[model samples]
Target: MHSSNLRLEEPIRMASILEPSKPNFFPAMTKIVGTLGPKSRTVEIISGCLNAGMSVARFDFSWGDTEFHQETLDNLKKAIKSMKKLCAVMLDTVGPELQVVNKSEHPISLQADTMVVLTPDQDKEASSNLLPINFHGLSKAVKKGDTIFIGQYLFTGNETTSVWLEVDEVKGEDVVCMIKNSATLSGQLYTFHVSQIHIDLPTLTDKDKEVIRTWGVRNSIDILSLSYTRHAEDIRHARDYLSKLDGLDQTQIFAKIENIEGLKHFDEILQEADGVILSRGTLGIDLPSEKVFLFQKAAIYKCNVAGKPVVVTRVVDSMADNLRPTRAEATDVANAVLDGCDAILLGAETLRGFYPVESISTVGRICSEAEKVFNQDLYFKKTSKHVGEEISHLESIASSAVRAAIVVKASVIICFTSSGRAARLIAKYRPTMPILSVVIPQLKTNQLRWTFTGAFEVQYLLCFSSCSWLPLPS
Candidate 1:
């Protein structure tokens, strides 16, 4: 019997498959990473996301505790088991970001032009007149007349609840500021920005280390998205830390470019990181709003030439509240797909959004449509030219395979990869046909490890006999 018709009795773990021979196959080469939160933590929602084409489930450690994340992880596993779909799990660390904490369980309203004290003291509970920040050098970092903006405005562009303040005095550990605008403040993590000054902080925090040591190791996450990645050293530090752990040593590290410093050292960071995530939300705050798009294009192009996977987030942020994306947002998603990004990450749109499932479906639809117009041949030429003199053996094989596929008018390219490198190399050539990758089962769990690569689909075979192979069309 032919491999395409071959069937196995034993169960196998597989991700969503793309069949080029079938009319129903939705060929969206760009993957989707959906953030899991209160609104989308249930198995049903996760399953919906999976069916809608979510390739990864991301848990933001900035907001949830170990217990909460563990519950969500369990729910995700249940959904994967029930749906029999392989979805990679990612842990997004808090890094050295600053946030506000209050004594009141409820949000406090701050009136404009009122004086309030901002302290780094965790022991002090925030009141209507005082707010506590997570960082300790608040007083030393700010001087009189310096401006401070607090809220999620930078991240979500929702300025309705954000507060602006101007520093009036620095007293020991407390910085007194006069509120420039009226806004409601909550305990939710808020981005801190000071005008004309760089607040130096460690790349990874104590809480981040604790979370990785405790929750990350326990769950055996597939990816770690290091927030506020400033330099190559940060990536090395994270890799070093993970190397000490048993199962986590294999975890892929993705550096998130969020600030101006990160962008300044992006080349170094990219060389060290397994992948890169263009975090437009925080990047917008660090640079002019208009420049963000330019940076996005440049970063994506570089990652493509380097044969590294890059993910773009905050593409359809408006869909967090609305059922459908705006025309511009839709265009943005399409543009990202056209730019050759490996993945699009949905943060607020899925995390706390009212329409998580619809968001994923919408992005996936946009990507599929945009992919139709992608000039794959041109991209391939450009990528090959960029690799000029130093093409490796794997690159030559991958390039040849893609060329052969095109010349033969093949329906799909199926690659059996042990470390997923061959599949990634093939994907780097930008083949029009879908590439299906088969990986061996991991020894620890006796399950196929689904590492994030540019492959269109993946499957894990327990053994050689258990493989349900699919032959190339003749």
Candidate 2:
């Protein structure tokens, strides 16, 4: 019923046990974003994620050095080339984050009601007890009664540990603080503040800038995730920096809403950013633990209203250690899908977990089951805020195609998409029938599967794109 020249490659060797000729359409729409780390950094492991239903490969810049990340990027590229897969590399920024620096070789243990001085500059007065913070302008940002949490989570208006700080006084670089919670701390990087304080720091570190010019641009990094995004200005600054390297138009910027300010300024950040990452771990540090769930739900719904793709990260922290996820973790992922998240990101679970591949595997399954009862009709009703004044011909055609498929009870809706625009519009409408969108190799191989590049493909129509989709047995 189609052109003889059209040859669409439905991957016979895709990641799931389900038959590719007849995929479980439910699982393909929700993507699994796996991070590359010690457990899964090699070409083999990276390819494993691709075969395991993962659509995105996240590179956590928080811990690794430049050489290490560069090598990882090299391996990722090699894997993509070897397998001939199309996957997006998410380059995550380390910070504009604050860390506690001390002169003591051992970790410091502070008792409740104790006095601890946090200074932006080096503390010369008390060498043994002084806490030197990496973030500048802390003294100017905090007021009396503002709380500082060091690895402590506040849940349901109750403090988990007494190892927290309350701002007592501020003078220049010196911030006089009293320990409200007793926490033994060392040279652990990253800080959480109850105070909605903005700091003076470059959005991207100098090293981040250098890497952007190198691996970020040259290595074809698809998404640059800006961590600790506090304001819209942060994204603008990053865009300006990317522009300098001529990579502004080439890549998309994803803002990671980690703190209270980021949550408040998400609208502004969304205005400049291509998408959003609900950085839950850092959010736990900044807000009450119980509040994080509520915030995530709100953030996802709000992002949908704004038409920005939002990826929820660190949903399965316990799975990093445990082989199987806790019941709560499974529920958490389901809720994210129910909330209409574009994707869910696995951080430590895929990066340093015992079962990297299995984690990615499980997440896909959970999202699949969740999507079964996702209430697509109700979701559309709630999420649709505005419609275009003029319905474009493309929309008209896409809608008609879906309707026709449903009427005929067609197993699939195949669209010969050249630019992928028509295919996206069809999938966005979330037709009950499956979609098999045929596209040029301009779209990635991963784009072949799932509704959001899942469970869909048209015959590979060769074109003028740089990447080519070769013939694979259906």
Candidate 3:
């Protein structure tokens, strides 16, 4: 009777439609992605990292072999299970990187007036000690006396009457070739007047396709992080390959933006891509410093408009590898979160850094704090209307829908749009609830990767008739 009375003492309350399980807003938890490496390969260590804050772990395909990668992936899975967290594995590939094979043990230093030869020698690992400057086609594209940079260090002279070069005594393995002449580096095509033709690698290598297929068969990987993506064709081919994987034809693919071509074909890439990662390290070498910031900002705004989740990669400062991040670096991290990156990536910082725990914790703190400001501006903004429609009508509908989602305490607000215009407008209102925007086949859908700083749950439900709004997952 005492035990029965104790059971009967429990209060019973009727469920209410408007009742929300939790009042805290801002889309559940801020997604934190960390790259997996030697330092954090152990199951316990990886699990600790996941508990600390990492929500995603990227497996770099450019490094370890398949067997090693599989072992590591299994360890990560164990960690995820032990911690009881929903973690996603991202497959990062080594894209088409232009590298010079170097033969010299030490980096060759170039001093001004040092004549160097540009060769077609496959054996040569680095730039030659001396070479014949091809100025016959100087006026065609590259002129005399043009300063060319090799990797991040050396700068050689251009064509002049004498081809005399003051080379900076440089020393390094294969360095990336950079030309500076002031003729706007637009367009994807670059005419390098060299004796040897550049190597054109396949968008998806056989081994890469195999690993992607492995990802499908395992069903452990939730997201595919494609690196060095050059164009829409690359995304299309990747999608096709993924579709063939045992179980991954439908897995989410996040295109990593690290090259100029990828940026040029931003809209198309975004449309074809399921998500995006703004990898800054490789991108720094790919684009000029002045342009990188502006380009990143533009991508962010565009993604915001498209409602795709953008991941800001390479947040390296001293803090990433060191125990404490620099004040400026801390601010940089905060600014990206403010700029609307859905998540930020920690590469060597958490993988092989001295302070993986500290780095993860600090980044999480910065994201949490920055989100306050982001949320303030997000919820207050007005909705965008189509050209022919009444602005007031569109704005009113969007605001009302967002408010309804918020009051109902829905997990996600599902947006069904043919043109994706309604979703963008609704996103601008930025309800506290997550907005799962579903769009038909269109170019604008591709650009959404540049929009909101989160994930894009793309469902190819191409709306031929009706449009509706739904809530994101709780």
Candidates 1 and 3: which is better by TM-score?
Answer: 1
lDDT of 2 by residue, 148-243 (tens): 776422221224322577888887778888877655554444344555667677668887877777767766566789988888998998888877
* Clashes per candidate, residues 3 or more apart or on different chains: 0, 19, 50
Flag regions of model 2 displaced more than 4 Å.
1-27, 81-84, 102-105, 122-128, 152-163, 180-194, 246-248, 285-291, 382-385, 400-410, 432-437, 441-474
Ranking by lDDT: 1, 2, 3
What is the lDDT for 40 in model 1?
97
lDDT of 1 by residue, 99-145 (tens): 78764557878898899998888778777688888888778777999
Compared with the true structure, all predictions reach lDDT values of: 0.78, 0.67, 0.56
Off by over 4 Å in 1: 1-24, 113-115, 143-147, 152-154, 166-171, 176-180, 187-189, 195-197, 441-474
Q: Highest lDDT, which number?
A: 1
Provide TM-scores for the models.
0.85, 0.77, 0.64
TM-score for predicted model 3 compared with the true structure: 0.64
Position 191, candidate 1: lDDT? 63
